[model samples]
Target: MDRRHCLVTGANRGLGLEFVRQLLARRHHVVATCRHPGKATALNTLAGEYPGRLHVLPLDVAEPRSHAELARELALVTDGEKLDLLVNNAGVLRGSERFGHVQPADLEASFRTNAMGPFLLVQTLASQIADGGTVANISSEVGSIALRQEFRTPSYAIGKAAQNMATSLLAQALESRRIKVVALHPGWVQTDMGGEQAALTAQESVAGLLQVIDHLDEDDSGGFLDWQGQTLPW
Candidate 1:
C-alpha cells in the first residue's frame, strides 16, 4: 500500500493509541488527536520516537466549536494536502444502567460524544478528505437492534446506533466524491472501556481492523462490518 496521511481521534490511549502506533509503524504520516495534549504522555513519547511523522493535536470530540477549530488548524497544517484516512475512534461508554435508572444527562453525553462528534467532524473536514479516501467510524454490535437480546448499556448502544446511521448517511452524501464511509465493530478488545476480561487485546483488534480498512472500497460504503471484514447485520 502507498504511504498515506491519516488522522485518528481519541488517540491518547487504548484502541485509539494502538491505531496510531500501527499506522506510524506502517510509515504513514499521522495526525493523532486527544482531548488534552498535555496529559497524553504516551502519545507525546511516541511523537518523539517517530519525529516528523507523528503530530498530536488537542480535540474535544463533543464540542462543535472544537470541531470547527480542528478543521481550521488541520487545513493550515496540511496546506492543501488531503487526508487519505479518517478514523473516528473516539467514544465513551457510560455503564449499562437499568432503563428506569438511566440518567438523561449520561445519555445526552454519550450521544454527543459518540455520535454527533464523529458526524460533525466528517461534515467539517469533508473538503480536506481526499476524493476516494476512507472514513471508518468505530461502532459496536451492541448497536444492532436486530441483534439485541438484552437491555444493557442503553446510552452507549443508542449513541453507537446513531453513529451507524451517520456513517450510512455520509456514505451516500459523499458518493459523488467516491469517499467510502462505513461503521466497524472492533470486537471486545481489552481497552479501558472493554475491561481486562475482554476477549481481544488492543493490538489484536486494531490489527484486524486495519486489515478490514485496507480493503474497503466504494462497494463497501454504508455497510457495517467487523474487524475481519465480515458483513454485520444492521
Candidate 2:
C-alpha cells in the first residue's frame, strides 16, 4: 500500500493510540492529537521511535478554538498536501444514570465530545482532506437504535446516534469529492472506556477496523459498519 498522510484525534490512548501505532507500522505519516500531549508519555515514546513519521499535537475535540488551532498547525506541516485519512476517535461516555436520573449536563457533555466535536472537526478540516480521502468516525453499537435492547449509557448512546447521522450527512455533502465517510463500531474493546471486562482487545479491534478502512469505497459511504466490515443498521 502507498504511504498516506493521516490524522487521528484522541490518540493518546486506547483505540486511538492503537490506530496510530498500526498506521505508523504501515509507514503512514501520522499526526496524532490528544487533549494533553504533555501528559501522553506513551504517545511521546512512540513519537521517539517513529521520529519524523509521527507528530503529536494537543487538541480538545470539544472546543472549536482547538480545532481551528490544529488546522493552522497542520497547514504549516503539510503545506498544500491533502490528508488521506482522518480518524475522529475522540469521545466521552458519562452518566449511565437511568431515565429519571439522567442529567442534562451529562447529555450535553457527551453530545459535545462525541457528536458535535467530530462534526465540527470534519467541517473545519474538509479542505485539508484529499479529494478521495476517508473520514472514519469511531462509533459504538450502543448507539444503534435498531439494536438497542438494553438501557445503559444513555448519554453516550444518544450522542453516538447523532454521530452516525453526522457521518451520513457528511458522506452526502462530500459526494462530489468522493470523500468516503463512515461510522465504525469498534466492538466491545477492552480499553479505559470499554472497561477490563470488554469483549475485544484494543489491538484486535483496531487491526480489524484498519482492514475495513483499507477497502472502503463510495458504496460504503454513509454506512454503519463493524471492525469486521459487517454492515450495521443505522
Write down the TM-score of every candidate: 0.98, 0.98
TM-score of 1: 0.98
Q: What are the per-residue Cα lDDT tens digits for candidate 2 across 1-234? A: 899999999999999999999999999999999999999999999999999889999899999999999999998776567899999999998855887899999999999999999999999999999999999999999999999998989999999999999999999999999999999999999999999999999999999999999999899999999999999987
Off by over 4 Å in 1: none
For candidate 2, which ten residues in a row score worst on lDDT?
73-82
After aligning candidate 1 to the native by TM-score, how far in Å is the CA of 199 from where it should be? Answer: 0.8
lDDT of 1: 0.94
Ten-residue region with minimum lDDT total, candidate 1: 72-81
Backbone clash pairs for candidate 2 read none
Give per-residue CA lDDT, model 1, range 1-234, as digits (tens): 688989999999999999999999999989999999999999999999998788899899999899888988887666668999999999999985997899999999999999999999999999999999999999999999889999999999999999999999999999999999999999999999999999999999999999999998789999999999999988
In model 2, how large is the Cα lDDT of residue 136? Answer: 99
